[model samples]
Target: MNETFKPGPEAVEIVERESCFRGFYRLDRLRLRHRLFAGGMGPQISRELFVRHDAVCVLPYDPQRDAVVLIEQFRVGAMDKAANPWLLELVAGLIDTDEEPEQVAHREAEEEAGLQLGALWPITGYFPSPGGSDEFVHLYIGRCDSQGAGGVHGLAEEGEDIRVHVWPLEDALQAVKDGRINNAASIIALQWLALNRAEVRGLWV
Candidate 1:
């Protein structure tokens, strides 16, 4: 939800009840302080949310082959929001309490695509959705063998049914433009690859 509010000494009311559901990710129910205008000062408002989430997205670049591995799955959140349920996304997962982002990336790659990562090229460490959630994703481009290591793979117990595809680097970028790939992480990863394709391809996969 794209919302804007103004800040003043005005009082805010919890017009509705707030609740939270804790799962792999937590959902927070909020009744805004009130809808006040920022008065042309730009949208400025603070939230009471303080969540810490660690995630990783694998680019899965293959230098010699000029390919990348990606996974497709049905996203419930998107369906709930009236968006397309099936989504093309990068290999990603939330970091458990003790795991590092890099380790999570590698682990997710194997779990979702059955590929072993070679070298990892880290992009940036930032928040994915900051307004309401304290979620953050640690982005990385990992080199891996994409010859015959990609296809359908996922943990059935987790209700995950993922389809892995080994895509030519250029075709993947084209898919991004054509809206065939419609997930934030996937879009960002592809754009990053577009800008750094030469350098990424120079490295051994």
Candidate 2:
């Protein structure tokens, strides 16, 4: 793919940032020291209130049969916008301060999808919503046996009622067109798989 957006000519520095709260998650109020721009001149950019987080999403692929595993859960964020708040999504979770992103992907797969992930392959690392939230998601694709994947398993303490769904590559691709798989991470994962299906499937056997 051709490059869409290149980096700006320059960036400003953050003079200081203070934490408003440091309970479970810390919230910060930032102040920028200087400003700069791209293409000779641009608007003054300010730095403030950037929420930092580490997240992971997995695209579970069955290389032998060319399939994928997905999970369906009720998303509170989408509840207000969607007619059906319950959404079908890829397995994902936040990386704790003590845990690595790959480890988080493995744990979430077992907790949410009841499958073991093999050879964690990093797809990309990016910010899902940079304009408002400082959340960064590390995306991955893990090989698995999709034939026998079953059951609904979720964390009882977290009240997660997630159902696992094993899907062939074609069916999941259709879900994207039908507007069923709506989330950004999930959508990106599927599209990536679609592009690289043949190579991915050749790995297991």
Candidate 3:
């Protein structure tokens, strides 16, 4: 794969920007223009972007038990489209302060699953929905003991009612295959583990 076409941030032009909403989550309407593929400036396009702080999601894996820890919680956004609004997801939290992504990952692991992570392996980072949202997610696979992982744990002040579940690696992958695990970060982390489990286990050992 030898290619030489790269466009940087300098290629985009921000003409105007205005705040659309300023609540828990923010929405910004932007008027911008970018260089077209044919080598010219495109027309100014106006779009609303959902702005959110960066977040971290960790797939807590217990290699000794060959199991993974997951959390179940209610999601309002999926209420209309999903059969059940309560979803099985990886331990995740937003970077609300000056804490680093690794710190958020560890903190969320304790808060959501009541487990302490061991070795942490960075999987990848991505924008869940770049077309409309600027929510960047840093994903990781964290080592943990799943024996005592299941329970109802969450911060009451945050309105979180989370149930922890420990699933065998095979079962988790099956859920991913059958659409049971539909969250983007969870799906990506599970699939990545499925492909790299041997290497990860070796490293952990």
Candidate 4:
């Protein structure tokens, strides 16, 4: 790391950009170059970037019951590499225009799992993929009452048919170890819970 060479948006220069595809999601072609770590700017190159709205994901955990609510959905993106395309994931939704990330978390939890979440604990915010996609995610663990939080719920108009699952906290963690819960956001949240379960429980209980 250089003392004066800071890494920021200004370090990258977008020479030219054009929309490549736009439908549900978007794609853009960019010719760009950026400041190099060793010395000067890297060579100008072409790249196709996947464009998507910033999104939010919340894992609903019941501190009293020591359980977590997760959802299973068909992910077309995973079809090529995964043995089973349906992924067990946190309740998630895109941050709509004028909608706060926390609001999206609460809304998706109810929409996908029938659970009205309590106070949301910030887990971490990250880019699920930065190499090729502009998909930033805000992750959270929302305290909830998971008394009856299992179902098949999703918006039909959006063609979503999601299956909700309530797992004991340990089981969810084990699923991650067993490679069952392979999605990035879910993996990150569950790992964080595994490390900070007691403190997180104290936040609600």
Task: Please report the candidate that would top lDDT against the real structure.
Answer: 3
Q: Model 2: runs farther than 4 Å from truth?
A: 1-10, 21-23, 38-50
Q: Name the top TM-score candidate.
A: 3
lDDT of 1 at 106: 89
Q: Model 4: number of clashes?
A: 0
Q: Output the better candidate (1/2) by TM-score.
A: 2
Task: Please provide, for model 2 over 99-174, each residue's C-alpha lDDT reduced to its tens digit, 9 standing for 90 to 100.
Answer: 9998999999999999999987788888887765688999999888887897888999999999999988899999
- At residue 159, candidate 4 shows an lDDT of 92
Give me the displacement of residue 61 in model 1, in angstroms.
1.0
Q: Estimate each model's TM-score.
A: 0.77, 0.84, 0.96, 0.95
Worst 10 residues of 4 by lDDT: 1-10
Let me know the TM-score candidate 3 reaches against the reference structure: 0.96
Q: Candidate 1, after superposition: displacement of residue 26 in Å?
A: 3.4
**Model 3 misplaced stretches (Cα beyond 4 Å):** 1-6
Clashes of 2: 0
lDDT of 3 by residue, 1-205 (tens): 2134347898899999999899989999999998776677789999999999999999999998889999999999999999999999999999989999999999999999999998789999999999999999999999998886788999999999999999999999999989999999999999999999999888776
Writing each residue's lDDT as its tens digit, candidate 1 over 93-169 gives: 88876988999988999899998988889988778778766778899999887888766898999888999888898
Candidate 1 residue pairs in backbone clash:
6-36, 6-37, 6-38
lDDT by residue (tens digit), candidate 4, 23-90: 97999999999997776798999999999999999999999989999899999989999999999999
Report lDDT (Cα) of residue 73, candidate 2: 91
